[model samples]
Target: MSKTLPPAPWTRRDDLARLVAALGIENVRWVGGAVRDTLLDIEVKDIDAATPLLPDEVMARCKEADIRTVPTGIDHGTITAILPTGPVEVTTLRKDVSTDGRRATVAFASEWRDDAARRDFTINALYAHPDTLEIEDYFGGIDDLAARRVRFIGDAHQRIREDHLRILRYFRFQARFGAELDETAEAACAELAETLKGLSRERVAMELLSLLSLPDPSETVARMHRLGVLPVVLPECCKKGVEALKASIETERRESEAPDPIRRLAALLPALRPVAETVAARLRLSRQQRERLTCAAERNEGDVADPRALAYTESRECAIDRLLLQGASTTPLRGWDIPQLPMKGGEIVQRGIATGPEVARTLRAVEARWIAEGFPDRQRVEAILQEFLQKRS
Candidate 1:
């Protein structure tokens, strides 16, 4: 790996160049994930920098440079500078004054090493000069990155005590980038696994979903289960959930589909609607996410055989999830757009079914027949409606 921040498209942007110049190249260094990922040659999604200047000073510098600034986390000593390329988050160097395993109070400092020490993982504490692109290592972050190791900055137990969410974050980073788990870190995470319950459900859900989104997280997740971490966070996940997740990944790869976190979560859970719903609620998932998860949990034993019918009856998205979980083929649904029922209740009323409950019932009957007939054309829907009307008469 290069000793300096590797050149990438984001690094080559003219707007970023101006922003860096405005922030004073000597006063700022690219920090955190941007620096870590640049070294690892991964796709960098967000840019972050650390500066010795206070948040107000950072904002003032951006203003002088004619750059828009957002007080994204000003209380935490951070400001976001918006450039033509995108927003770059610049935070004043800070050392934790106090921590309660949830939030930290910090005082801004002028030393980069102080900020680095406050970070959770050594690999994430790397800093890179914007102009020189030279790397700065206060801890052996570069070496840790080279070793594919994800370890805490100082004491693993102390780090976990400072923020309970780091327990889940450890496994998530390991799943994505680690070749071998640091034994000390693993032990600390295991010992402090229960502390994870103290963290917010939203934070836990975010980390879990990110882990599940990875190409293959089965091994890492299984390791977490062995360490009792999974039991503490998600006792609802079945003992066989890891195997199901592996199966789900293989099925997704076979079908050439992207890995979906919610669907994979459905695989990890017991195939029961209530169980899925309960887990979703516990995780505080969005309404759409909850619906998809519960829908995937539905028992559709014989339904995967007719992909279209399954899609029509229980949504294309849910049907795809069920088929993937069942290890069935999703080829039939490729480019097969789901269609409407092709008939309306108003049209049925116009056909003299009376504008009452009869019309609604008659419409539903027609829809059921239409769905059974594979969602035929409007003419076929008309014929189905006529059959229902005749029966009602």
Candidate 2:
């Protein structure tokens, strides 16, 4: 069965048209996520084309067409064509010849079916003709797409054995597209969960972060936890964390807040500095991400009802993250609006206070008082400063 993709901006681009014309329409077709997403009515970000042409041939054709080409993954048969709209990745059809449960050694193939067979999931094994927009489902990808099912293309265990990262990809795709778990895939993942340890921390971190970024990852994560995959990947993730994540997701929906991966991650683990630090280090997160995670975890442990106090210690964004995470906890936090300090350091200095550490100390003291008094009028703040000056004199 074939379906036509509605006219999209990408379909109307001259560069894409020229490339398709140059490569010969039959030799190239849109494949992978772009096709899957278009079929799902989701916005497609990157356009990936599969071709029977070799890497050098692709490069030569692009050069002849005067289209900018970057050999982004040349050895692996990928070239990035810089179209007017954006970069489109084109890859020569390939089949895996060797596998070690962590990586694959592949040999270039001219058959589109072979390429489709090598893909991890049925929904991803789809292809569409460049000109007619006719989809070609070598597997039952169309049926799976219609059902919103995330199932491996062929044997679930074999696909996972070829690349252990597919275990995480399974959950990520399920979170992104499926409404429920595919039992066979789940069972395969459970059997192969230990193989996930062989994957690089960077790869695991990226996949986990992507999973956490979904609209609501609680259900998928709970499924992963039930299958024991979470323990293999992140031993620190606990039952309390899962519950907290569900609550945090609910609060986000109720409040219409943006999805935050770090906050969600913090909610999935104990709100302790050491736990956050350990998770950050294990995932090889950046310094800024590590610091923010630690701050959110630390702030979630104590009283964060006073926005002024939280803002004084942490930035507004950090305070909000802390509040959201803490809100998911069993303890009730005081609800308060973030307030701005009425006085500046220079203003305090002009009041006869020294411009050194003394001025900084006085500003903090006055700010504390203003917060304690619930941010009073400017006259009251002035009176407080004057009193300080008189006492110092």
Candidate 3:
């Protein structure tokens, strides 16, 4: 059975419509995530299409249509059509000729079923006509989508063996779509979990981050832990932290907080610098991400009884992350807000303190006194600076 999707923004784009018309609708069809997401009423981020047209033909058609084209993945039969709406990736239908547990050498085919069969999961194998909104489900993807089941298209182990990353992808898709784990898929993932080590850290991090970005990734992560998958990727994770992650996700929901991968990650590991450093290096985290994670862990170590002190020591954002992690652990959050210090460097300099390190030191002393005295008035601030100057003399 086939169902029609309502007119979505992507479906109604004039530029996309013109490009499809120029290419000849018979040779092209919308495919992949865009089609699947539209059916599920999820906002489609990218529009992907599959065609029987070869790469050269795809380029020639784009030329005739006056649409810009880039051979983003030409060797793999993909061409990026730059339309007014956005870049639409059009790949020629392909069939895998061989696989080496990581990547596949493919042969371009004219059959949509061939392409569908090569996909990782049935839900991802869905396609749709560019104009008619008619869906093409060679497998029982529509039924599986409705059932909220994430299953490998054919043989689970074979599919995973073709690309070890599929193991992580399985859990990620399950988390995002609120799909239950398929038993066969789980068994295959468990058996093949170690194969994830063969994959590049960047690939692993991308999948892991995507999984963490889900509304509530705690359940899926806990399942991953149970299946012995977590240790392979995040060796620092413990049962206690995994359990804390569940409570953290609930707190996020109750407080209407946005999904925060780093904060959730902190909840899933010990709040220690070494642990953060190890995970950051292993995952190739960005410098900013690493700093934030480390700072949050540092803040979590001590009593964050004063938000101002925390803000002075780390940052406001880091303070909030610490509070969230503390809340997750059922620890009381102190310091409602970060109060600004009522002193400045110029004031210290005017108090006859030398420039550079001395001025910085005097400023810190004055700010500490102010914070300790509940942020006193400017008169008191001047008096503190005067007293500090007298002591320096």
Best TM-score goes to which candidate?
Answer: 1
Candidate 1, residue 296: lDDT: 93
**Arranged by TM-score, best first:** 1, 3, 2
Least lDDT summed over 10 consecutive residues: which range in candidate 3? Answer: 328-337
Clashing pairs in 1: none
Candidate whose lDDT is highest: 1
Question: Which ranges of candidate 2 are over 4 A from the true structure?
Answer: 300-304, 328-356, 374-380
TM-score, per-candidate, Cα-based? 0.96, 0.91, 0.92
Question: How well is each residue in 1-393 modelled by candidate 1, as lDDT tens digits?
Answer: 667888777878898888888888899898889988888889999999899999888888889999999999999988999888789998999999999998898999888899999999989999888888898888898988998999899999999999999999999999988996799999999999999988889999999999999999999988998899998878988669878888989999999989999999999899999999899999999999999999999947776768888898889999999999999989999999999888778897788767899877887888888878778899988888777777767
lDDT of 2 by residue, 11-110 (tens): 7788899999878899999988988887777898999999999999998998899888999999889999998889999999999999998778999998
Writing each residue's lDDT as its tens digit, candidate 3 over 1-393 gives 346666788898999888888789888788879988988889999989899999999999889989999999999999999988689999999999999787899999988999999999998998888778888898888888888888899999999889999999999998887566589899999998999989889899889888888888888999999999988999899899898888878877765667888888888888889989889898999999899888777755453466555655677667667866776332223435555666788767776667799888778888888877766788888898888778777
Question: Which residues of candidate 3, in runs, are more than 4 Å off?
Answer: 301-303, 328-346, 373-380, 390-393
Evaluate model 2: give its TM-score.
0.91
The candidate, 1 or 2, that scores higher on lDDT is 1
lDDT-based ranking, best first?
Answer: 1, 2, 3
What lDDT score belongs to each candidate, Candidate 1 first? 0.89, 0.85, 0.84
Error of 1 at 322 (Å): 1.3
